[model samples]
Target: MTNGPLTLMQQTSALRQAIRNQEHTGPTSGLATGAMQGNVVILPKEYADEFLMFCHLNPVPCPLIGVSAVGDYRMPMLGEDIDMRTDIPEYYVYRNGEEAERCYDISSLWQDDMVAFVLGCSFSFENALSQVGLTPRNIEEDVNVSMFESSIPTKPAGRFYGNTVVTMRPYTPKDAIRAIQVTTRFPKAHGAPLHFGDPSSIGINDLAIPDFGDPVSVKEGEVPVFWACGVTPQLAIKNAKLPICITHAPGKMLVTDLLDADLAVF
Candidate 1:
């Protein structure tokens, strides 16, 4: 299949199809410009209940957008035809708290007891940021948002427990405040930020080396701004050490049909 110029939403749909057909398998960071994107998790039915509770307990970092019935692969609520097994650009297979393999799709690993989850992603806030002329540095640099595992502890539910992970974008204090106001409208997408300014305060030791995503320049007067990221679930999934787990690869989001406005709250 040929990659061509398409609108954000159209590109997302096409990319999803490409993923399903094994034509395109990479990060979806900037693919669907203004569309709502999501982080995904697939777990066994036995662990679904507790994981759901974990999400409820820590809604900011784990905003639950869609959930599938046990053994179901289709997420009708997210789009006309969103297959959890293949919609995301890439998948990370985990085994006993370890990353086993990264693949384009999960059809070969499907299980009858599996349940899928879709969580809000930071991409939802980009439109708002751009609207106000504070485009994120990650977007400007054309790279994935920088992510780090934070010291902030999450409320545990059963075996699902871990520190929250965050995504960073650098901006001057004045622009940082504007970013907070713009992101506040989409509570499902993390809503504002947990902390800004000092990286050491949040347990991040290095600004140049992120645990995930490429680093962008922090101008002389700019301070790094962070937001609760959907990747938090991946860390939690690792800590859970389930027999098997599946998640969207970092930057490889599940693009949905829902508009950003659909998730905005006043």
Candidate 2:
């Protein structure tokens, strides 16, 4: 609580505890540096099968890292003590496929038949990019990475389907190429840029107004780089019009015990 220097694991654990206690409710990006972060999607058992198939068909934006067993809130595969209902800084509750409310934890809303799916997040690759001296502007500004819904549609699976959502980072063309190379190592972390250069090409007309999360400034000489984002699933969840669904708030990811290197291909 005092901002005293804490070790990486300690910081992550403290953040999770604060979240569970409802003392901290904000974006998790650029925090617990080096630890792998995840985007969470929780839904009832009835919707689990179709959602799983949706993730399978859209691997780029939904590379699953861990899944809680039906009726279980713990994800032992992702961390030693990850609690699906309370670990994330913030949660979004969707009713009839629309965001109904945001809360610190989902413990009160969790049901016995609910399942939680953890998806690899671009925040993991952002850490790798930072290590190589290519830190994203959003991190430098201490803001959430800009995310937008795009024209590129995801492959439909059962009742789940929607266009992809993407996160943007501005970098010089030279740095953008290196970022692509560095990010390519973490496939689970949405490896590599989906596109670079003009935002209009991806159906993002106004860089200043992101469909999700805060917008970071794109410097004059820098081009906006786009990466397939885990938030893409929420759009699908919305399209499905499920009775209820819960997801990590935009940019607020679940910090895990696994190191970012554990997800790197090389």
Per-prediction TM-score = 0.94, 0.94
User: For model 1, what is the error of residue 10's alpha carbon versus the real structure, in angstroms, after optimal superposition?
Assistant: 4.6
* CA lDDT scores, all candidates in order: 0.89, 0.90
- Collision pairs in model 2: none
Tens digits of per-residue lDDT, candidate 1, 153-214, equal: 99999999999999899999999988989999999899999999999998999989999888
lDDT of 2 by residue, 1-266 (tens): 55788988898888878877878887777678888999899999999999999999999999999988999999999877888888888889999999999988788999999999999998888888988999989889987788999988999998899999999999999999999999999999999889998889888899899998788988889999999999899999999999999998878889898888998997
- Clashing pairs in model 1, backbone N/Cα/C closer than 3 A: none
In candidate 1, which residue ranges exceed 4 Å CA deviation? 1-12
